[model samples]
Target chain A: DAGITQSPRHKVTETGTPVTLRCHQTENHRYMYWYRQDPGHGLRLIHYSYGVKDTDKGEVSDGYSVSRSKTEDFLLTLESATSSQTSVYFCAISEAGENQPQHFGDGTRLSIL
Target chain B: AQSVAQPEDQVNVAEGNPLTVKCTYSVSGNPYLFWYVQYPNRGLQFLLKYITGDNLVKGSYGFEAEFNKSQTSFHLKKPSALVSDSALYFCAVRRPRGNQFYFGTGTSLTVIP
Candidate 1:
């Protein structure tokens, strides 16, 4: 909960629908990340941004995309929600993109049926 | 690429007993390792990290991690366990030049009363 806030703490959506999760931070950190948490997978990185408009794919970024229009906001979008996409999404921020410790938000739980 | 491994899928310990969650990592250069914990309905929280310097690094919640270079291991340990300490734990690693952290699958810890 380190100065990070994720919107839509819980959401139930249908398959094939589009979903967007928002992460806002007061810390103005240089790096932001989006991750999904599942039972067996633990947490997998979906996307990350080093700065505004700079984004990169992660290990599990196949169906998800992210955007950072401003330093304080990082958005994760699921182009077409799938049952497999039902998981808790977490956002984290760090002062630098290197080996620094990242602080996380509460997370947004999404359920797709 | 850096990687982390958490061998145990689940661990159960009685309250007030000593607890340990195993973690190991692989990286080319000097490795930067970390441990994070997640409670039910909560996001991941930073526990401890191993940079250079000391082999043992102390962190929040009275948790500590020992970095064993020979074994390439950074294990989380607590002298006394509490019921509140029962949660999901994740191990992460980052290379010296890497921009993102690589996380392990995670281990679920159950501290029994």
Candidate 2:
């Protein structure tokens, strides 16, 4: 348990609707990451933050956005939900050092109808 | 580009039998390899990682991975399988200083009782 909490463990929304998932960590980790897990696709990074107000896009950044205004909170938003965006989203935190392993939250399962 | 491949979509093993899940990766420069396990409806948990040092790396839950640079592989192994070990396993790769990691498609491991 890395002291990470993901809000809304499960959600169902209609297509074209906006949705935001929040990740809060008690540990003062320097890096936070958002990822989506789908069948046959493992876990793909959506976005990541290295520090407060410092964020970067990942390989699967399309249709998603993220923000981190504080070290303990990271938010991922789906501007317009689609059926393809239905997946399990996970948040992870890690320290700022080489050989550090990332610890993950339970995850948020989002469904787009 | 850094990426990992899990050749098997599923692996089945009997209880008390040795088990292995294959993983191969391609990356520029020295590779930082990792293994994770995910239970149903849960987030991925870090199992082991190979950053630098010994080729054989061990982690939680009696799991170990052998890093073979010549083969470009880091296959996860366990001496004896347990029913509790039935889950999805993923292999990931990252560059030494890269911000993101690339993951394999994942392999479902089933341990028969």
Candidate 3:
């Protein structure tokens, strides 16, 4: 919970279409992250933002892009959806303090047809 | 690169009995470890973490984890198991100054009544 919300809890898109998932937060946490969860894969980070307009790629950043122009909003986009890109996506926010645990949103389920 | 291992894929326990979900991690130098839980159709929620200080770390829902440097393990334990404890558990590890966490495949725990 933790004041985090993921828009379009479920979504379906064509393989060649572009899809974007939005994450909103009420808390003004300095760090936000995008992660995808799949069976046998656990959670893999796609991208993360340390501050407004600052972003970095994670281990699974391929085929995904993210942007955060504001502190409370983070967006993840799949430029061209693929069957392999279908997964449950989660957004998390973390405090600026060191070693603090991250809070997560419910998640968005994406399906590519 | 950081990695975490959840040795068991599933663990079953009767209600009121003690429960444990094992986790082990690998990282260079000292590391930061974390635990998260996910219910069906939901994202992960923070349980607890091993940052520094004592090896035994207490978390939410009457859960706790022990950080063993020599063993490279952080196992989650609960004195009593509840039916509601049936869910997926994840263990994660990160470097001291790292921004992203590496997660394990996950373990499914079922608490029977």
Per-residue error (Å), model 2, residue A60 = 1.2
lDDT of 2 at B39: 91
For model 2, the TM-score of its B chain against the native B chain is 0.98
Docking tier of model 3: it is: medium
Q: Write the per-residue lDDT of candidate 3 for residues B32-102, one digit (tens) a residue.
A: 88999999988789999999999999999999999899999999999999999999999988787878778
DockQ of 1: 0.82
Worst 10 residues of 1 chain A by lDDT: A94-103
lDDT of 3 at B8: 97
Please give the DockQ score of every candidate, comma-separated.
Answer: 0.82, 0.75, 0.77
- What digit string (tens of lDDT, one per residue) describes model 1 on residues A7-111? 999999999999999999999899999999887787889999999999999999999989999999999999999999999999999988466998999999899
Which residue pairs show collisions in model 2? none
- Candidate topping lDDT: 2
Interface RMSD of predicted model 1 = 0.9
Question: Candidate 1 overall Cα lDDT vs. reference?
Answer: 0.91
User: lDDT (0-100) at residue A93 of candidate 2?
Assistant: 93
User: How much is the lDDT of residue B36 in candidate 1?
Assistant: 93
lDDT digits (tens) for residues A1-113 of candidate 3: 69999999999889989999999999999999999998888888999999999999998999999999989999999998899999999999999865888888999999998
Error of 3 at A38 (Å): 0.6
Which residue pairs clash within candidate 1? none
Query: In terms of TM-score, how similar is model 1 to the real structure?
Result: 0.96
Model 3 chain B poorest 10 in a row by lDDT: B93-102
